[model samples]
Structure formats: C-alpha cells, structure tokens
Target: MMGRLARQGGLAVGERIRFDGQVRLVLAVTGRAVILSELTSEPRLVPPAALFADGDFEIVDISGRMPLPPLSLLETLPQPVLEKALWWEGHILEILHGQAPDAPQGAEVRPEYAPTRSLTARERAKAGW
Candidate 1:
C-alpha cells in the first residue's frame, strides 16, 4: 500500500508521514517513484518499502507549522546587538515580533570601536620582575 501510494504521488513535499513508529517529512519524489528526503535528525532517502509495511502507515500534512529561521549562534545575542549587527536579524525580528527596531533605525554600527585601556609602568615592572 505504501509503495502504491508513493508511486501514485499521494505524498506531498513537506508532508509529515509516519512508518514503523518513525516520523519523517517527504521532501521530494523522483522518477523511480521513491520518497526522497525523509526527515530524521538528518534527512535520509530510502525506499518506501523499507519505510512502510504491514499496511501500517500514517501521513499528516504539517506544512502549517510555523517556519523557523535556521538556527545559529546569533540567537543568543541581545536584541539590540542583533538588530545593530545584521540587517537580516532586524527583518527576522520584525516578522517574528511584528514590529520594527525600537532602538532608532538607521543608526550606524561601528565594529571598530574599542574601549581604551590604561597600563601602568608599575604593573609592567611587577610582571617583568
């Protein structure tokens, strides 16, 4: 039944399907009628037969799940820093929060700025000794 369904294009891309207690998303279908791009921790392409057997398969369209931006280290940054550092961050925040940058848009971000440090000759001498 799974093979027949796969061959007949019953599965849609980004559609969530379950086989043998594993949940996967169909990413694409090929000329060989194979369900390609099964979602796991990582995507794995395999024959539909290996996925579905004993007439036990379930498919659910989860395309409506809110789209998440690709994960990155930037997610940890303060909102102000993110907005100031990257243009895309501002856009992402706008889409997610439904608002614009609150910290005065178009403000210049200076990456080269650094606080000055005062060094004492006594401290340098103590280190040398």
Candidate 2:
C-alpha cells in the first residue's frame, strides 16, 4: 500500500519536505513518488525529478493533510520557513546570473587626475616679461 511504502521510506503525506532547494508540503505519498506543493503565496506542483530518494530534505515539521490549511494560512507559518524561501529566491537569481551569493554591488569611482594643459603665451609672459 502507498501508506505502508511511505512509512517504510520514513516519509508521509502532510510532512514538510524540501525539493529543488525549496521547502514543500507533501500532499500525497505513493510507492514511487510524492506530490508536493511549495510553501509560498501561490503554491505549485514540484516536478518528480526534484524529489530525492535519499531523503535529502530537512523535515520542517509533521502536520498531516487534515491540519494543513489552504493558501490563506501561509502567513501563519514559522519564521524559518519564510526565511528559507527568501534565501531560495535569491539563490535562484544568483544561479541564473552566474554570480556569487554575497558579491558586492559596484560603486561609482572618482578619477584621480584633474584636467591640465599648457598655459597661454600671455599668461606665461606676465610671469617674466
């Protein structure tokens, strides 16, 4: 049974699992796969490939399907999950741009030298003749 398989794998529906570097709420469990919805304002299905058979996810908490609320309850979630989401978003942007996560922003630099030119002949003559 799917439930038995899930237990054997130490995973269950309604448990928070991470996939694709983002935290997700498990919606269903099966012998082969799990259905997950990312923790966000607008949740979406995570592709099957993203799930790790090795159980790489950090289990945030255990709340089965019945207790899990709909989109309306996202605001009440714990602070760590929200912070992880923010970090994940920034990570994705960095990956796309090939940038370091902590890279500094460029600053405007002032040039060291002032403009210079030869003095006019009249000005030169005033100094000596």
Candidate 3:
C-alpha cells in the first residue's frame, strides 16, 4: 500500500480511503483529502494515501500471489511497470470507495458536542496540539 500511495504522488481529491475497518470516500479537504467514516462526524484528513488504503481487510492467503519478475526481484523496477502498478492500486481504491455506505441524507449530522476546553501552555507545547 505504501508503494501504491508513493506511486500516485500521494492521495488526491476523489481518492478512496478506509478507517476503523470500514471503507470511506474522500470528500472535501483543508490540506489533504477529507475521509468520512460511519462513526465519524467531520471528515478527518489522513496524511498518506497509503494509510487510507490500508484499512482493515481480511488477510488473504499468499500462495497464489504472483511472484515478482526475476528482473524486478533483482533490481529496481522500470518506470512503466511501476506506473502500471500505481494505476492498478488506484483502481482498487476506487472500487473500495464505491462500496462505502452512502452518506445519510438530511441535515448533515452534527458532530457530538464536546465542551470546549481552554488551551494550556503545556498542551500548546506539544506537537500539533
């Protein structure tokens, strides 16, 4: 999945993502794609497209997994092959998004209300607090 995300130059608008074992669609965004899930209120911006694609899916047996070409196994893959792999990866992501549950209609569900807390110097001192 990391390989796939790296190949796409990272996630983009319209890309699909998964969270908490369920697939979701990329909606709006601030800096990155906004990922919406069943239990989530506002969409969350995930950092890497790979992470979004790495949602909880059952592991499959690898016995049937195609072996990488001998050349690719020995050395770096050619650009065209890499591009093709990325395209396939993106295609899979699209399919996952298509399978996601439709967003419920009506007024957008309000996120659960949480009392706001004053920021503390200590909290602000932490990264991205």
Candidate 4:
C-alpha cells in the first residue's frame, strides 16, 4: 500500500511505473528528481510531478529486470559528454608526458588538477578522485 506522501514523492530503485505509454524502472532518486530507464535502456531524469500528473501512471507487473544501454548507444554519447572525454584524454596525456598536445593554455586549471604545483602533488591530486 502506498501512503499519500509516497504517492507524491519517492519511488524505490527497482520499482517499475508506467510512463508515456512505456513502463520504466526507477534507477535512482533524489530530492528533486527520479531517474527512469525504459526497457530499451533509454534513461531520463524526470520531475516527480510529471509521474503523478492526472493520476496518469499505474503500478504494473514487470519482470523486474533492466539491462544497461546498448554498447552502440553508450559509444555515441552526445557532443557535450564527448567533450569531457576529450578533456580527459588531454588530461591523461598531460600526466604521462608532462604536457598535453592541443591543450589550451589553461587546461591545468580546468578539472581541479594542479599540475603546476609539483609532479608529486599532481599525482596525489589525480589519485584522490
């Protein structure tokens, strides 16, 4: 049985709720949002209100299994995400060879790494994360 507050808020990580004509599994929850993944592994974060709007969704029986996104989808991340990967590539190169090629003058200050501090400090800082 769902309490009134539960109906208004929280969904557990494994619960499935019907959404947009597709049933989705709850992958995560935060105070402000819920992360849902469809059977095809399409993931999205949604506000609580949308799920409960017009009493639209239903608690449905499901197999309780969800797979990760397909490798092809994982490989083709959006452009902004790909930019971070490029940044990491530059970061790795900087660590290995003491400098990163095609890196902007300020790449060292980019991702909280302090390569200019000292080689040992750089190693320690990178290892911390």
TM-scores for every candidate against the unseen true structure: 0.34, 0.33, 0.29, 0.38
lDDT of 2 by residue, 14-129 (tens): 57766667777776544445667755565554444445533555667654222212435545668888668657744433322223235455422112110111123222332344
Off by over 4 Å in 3: 29-33, 37-40, 49-129
lDDT for model 3 comes to: 0.38
Question: Once superposed on the true structure, which residue ranges of model 2 sit more than 4 Å away at CA?
Answer: 1-9, 39-50, 53-56, 64-129
Give the least accurate 10-residue stretch of model 4, judged by summed lDDT. Answer: 61-70
In angstroms, give how far residue 34 of model 4 lies from its true place.
0.8
Lowest summed lDDT over 10 consecutive residues: which window, candidate 3?
A: 109-118
**In candidate 3, what are the lDDT values of residues 92-119, reduced to their tens digit?**
3223222112333232321221112112
Computed on alpha carbons, the lDDT of every model, listed in order, comes to 0.46, 0.45, 0.38, 0.56
What TM-score does candidate 2 reach?
0.33
- What digit string (tens of lDDT, one per residue) describes model 4 on residues 1-129? 234334421345557778778877777655567788856657888887776662547656432222223346535898888778767866654543344556555344433333234444555656774
Model 1 stretches astray by more than 4 angstroms = 1-9, 33-41, 52-54, 62-129
Give per-residue CA lDDT, model 1, range 55-122, as digits (tens). 54777554422244564877788988775767765543333222334435444322221001112322
Q: Rank the candidates by TM-score, best first.
A: 4, 1, 2, 3
